[model samples]
Target: MFNITQWSLKHWLAAALLVFFALFPLSGDLFYTSLLNRMIVMAIAVASLNLILGYGGMISLGHAAFIGIGAYSVGIPAYYDIYNGWLHLALALIGCGLFAFVTGAISLRTRGVHFIMITMAFSQMAFFAFVSIEEYGGDDGLVVNGRSEFFPFGDIENNVTLYYVSFIVLVAVLYLVYRLVNSRFGGVIQGAKANERRMRAIGHNTYKYQLTCYVISGMMCGLAGALMANFSNFISPDMMGWVRSGELIFMVILGGSGTLFGPLFGTGLYLLLEEFLSRSALYTFVTENIAFLNDAQPWVYWQLPFGILLILVVLYARGGVDGFLSRWGSKNG
Candidate 1:
């Protein structure tokens, strides 16, 4: 029943990757599974960011604020013993949608750097607001009493189950985004992104389209936030901090903007590099062999190599890793 001819190389690769991930837990390592869960959740968030930034040409530095709101929606409710997973998810989506609708309405009026600054300001305001909430652990963050309940399916307490759920969600989000980007509405959004004046001249309400895209992106990120809270069993103001927002943007840019799978690759590569450098064998060797650096904190310097890699990617790989790979494959073919 399946037609292989209908699928592209990228689709095949995606299938293979999914199969690999599905069987990844056979290794019996919960740590790796947990890490992959985080990656999946983050991939969703980064993809949501890409929808607005890469395709819609809207740079929202406060995007993580929506994520935080989603997270806290779960955390705050759970703190009061409201353990319904579906309810938490609904609250997250609604809360994030309303916030994005209000903020996007205002932010869409600005362009370029002003949009970025306003988003950042909103995010900071959210971070501080969460910090000032005394009952929810304040600056220390809130620990979830238990994982979300899925009723008949039950809680996602098992690492493997959580990983699979997150993976399925990621796949769904990717497919949704792919469909959206290829749709007539998506064309209008992209056209507006390319040239708002032309789109406006053609009778397209650029503001409405952009705000709709923004709300959609925010809701997607909010879903990711719910998963994040479930993944860590903790929620904090730090989840929505400016630094996290910046990291999400970096993942989008590093993975190749406007490409559906780029964010996944970017998030995986960035997180993996961060993990590797933090406990790198090179760091160990340097600390052991170099006398002067023996007492130094090698982990502090882990970002140096990542920074260099980023610079190289930006300078040489114009379209990020995904674009570079596509070009390389085409050239070789």
Candidate 2:
């Protein structure tokens, strides 16, 4: 009943990407592979944001607060000797969900720009709360004792194994998001996004739908944060900072917000640029004659490239990289 030829191009492309990632360990050095891990984790977070912004039409500037909640969920528990691996992750998701529920309830009361402002306010509140918690390294941040281990085998600290773990989780979360967006509930959310008045006219509770999507997005972002903390063995208030939130938004916008694979591409692009800049500075000494060029801090001027790229994307590629590719494909086909 199932024919490979009948599969959509997007499905085929997703399959190809998955296969490529599966074999990536064999094709690249550990450093590159680790960078891939970070990209994939951040992509998961960005995709969660896309669910809210692209699907629900809720523009949240403070989404990083949920991520911070997730990271601290694991980090703080480990510090207190209350670590139970998956249980910690569950708690983080629950915490983010509750936070989103409460915040969305309040913020959704105000529409458009006001909603964004209220969300920003709550996110700042979360940032300050983490800063005030003198224990668990407070402002400095807490280093994870080690990567969490899966039960029975209990050796998940291995880098390669962690890569596979993260990959699997990324795949699973993406699939879950796809299903959520296609379901009946997802239709309501999307409807609300397209036209809140119409959704209300159809007897649907638009506010409830928006709030639900917001909570779901927050929970997913929180999950990514928990994994990120475990991956890096560190957690800090910086995770919840406004700039970090902006970066996440940048990832979504760069990748093509509505496309499932766009966030992955965006995160990959951003991290690759970051890794390149960081490594370029390390290699600067090799060109001793460069003089002043070598003297400058690579990161100090990194924002120029990103800012320029953002301007280009906004002016030309409104739908982002994935959208650009889609347009190209349609023309060629």
Candidate 3:
């Protein structure tokens, strides 16, 4: 049996990724650095989703709602002149965790489609709440005046400083997830996924375990949301919408669920493809080489290609990119 207790210390892909991220900002392009930051942020969120979906066997469509909660966690406090970063992050995380725990407790009473629907409903409730925060900017959203200033550490508004902070958090979260997935609690959660009925019959309170995992996932995503709000220096209701939730799901699916590093790869590829296609289309339209696309915006049409790619991956690659890569490597070896 492969020892679950022992993990390869020299994880080549992860190590390579760490080196790449460290060097990316040295290129000094604001756009590239900013995009990298966004990718890392979304990657963290997607990893949070995988904890429940891949490990705990919970299908939550409203995962991004926690991120919305987190963003507003800091955004609202900042609006009220609470500029302490650590305090704001702590409050947001605690609030999101408590909210998720309450919601998950109720939602875990149901299973399968019912659980999914209930979670979706809860997320919608959050979406409406943000929209109703008229004191903050309502539908139009609020432009952030500046990011939280960490006393003595200097301004977090600087891109390089923010990037490093985000990178450290991402690494820290990933390590925490690694520990969680290998712990005693993780065994029960994975068993629950494989056979909840058997786990329950064995005297495990599966509902509690599931609820705990759900709340942890939410709190982690909330952290990502807080970082995102700071990075973008803005907050809006749209961040909590169904579309944002769908995007999180897509990131998980695209990256190959069940793997620790898959989400990072998935988010990177997804964002890069979007950027490249959009830029190419803009250049083509300006040059008028592609006659049919001259007046049409490329981004609106890029979804068609993305949709096709999703269909292909679903039909041909059941295990996602990680699975596909493993198979290829084995065959080549």
lDDT of each: 0.88, 0.82, 0.82
lDDT of 3 by residue, 211-311 (tens): 88998899999989998899999989889887888888877877788777768777877888777765675455554766776677656776766678778
Looking at model 3, report the run of 10 residues with the lowest lDDT sum: 1-10
TM-scores of the models, in the order given: 0.94, 0.91, 0.92
* Residue-by-residue lDDT tens digits, candidate 1, 1-333: 037866555545556766777788888888888888888899999999999999999998999998899999889989998889999989999999999999899999999999999999888988999999999999999999887888988988777788888889898898889999999889988999899999989999889988999999999999999999989998899999999999999999988888887888789889998888778887677777989877877776767778888899889988786788777766755
Which number leads on lDDT?
1
Q: After superposition, how far is residue 309 of candidate 1 from its true place, in Å?
A: 0.8
- By TM-score, highest first, what's the ranking? 1, 3, 2
Off by over 4 Å in 2: 1-13, 153-155, 277-296
10 residues in a row with least lDDT, candidate 2: 281-290
lDDT of 2 by residue, 1-333 (tens): 037865555446667777877789887589878878887788889999999887788889999998899999889888876657777778888999999999999999987899888899999999999999988788899988866655675745777777787788888888887898889998998888888898899899888888888998999999888888888889999999988888988888888887777787778778877777545653444434567656676566556665786789868987877787677767766
Best by TM-score: 1
**Better by TM-score, candidate 3 or 1:** 1
- Decide which is better by lDDT, 1 or 2: 1
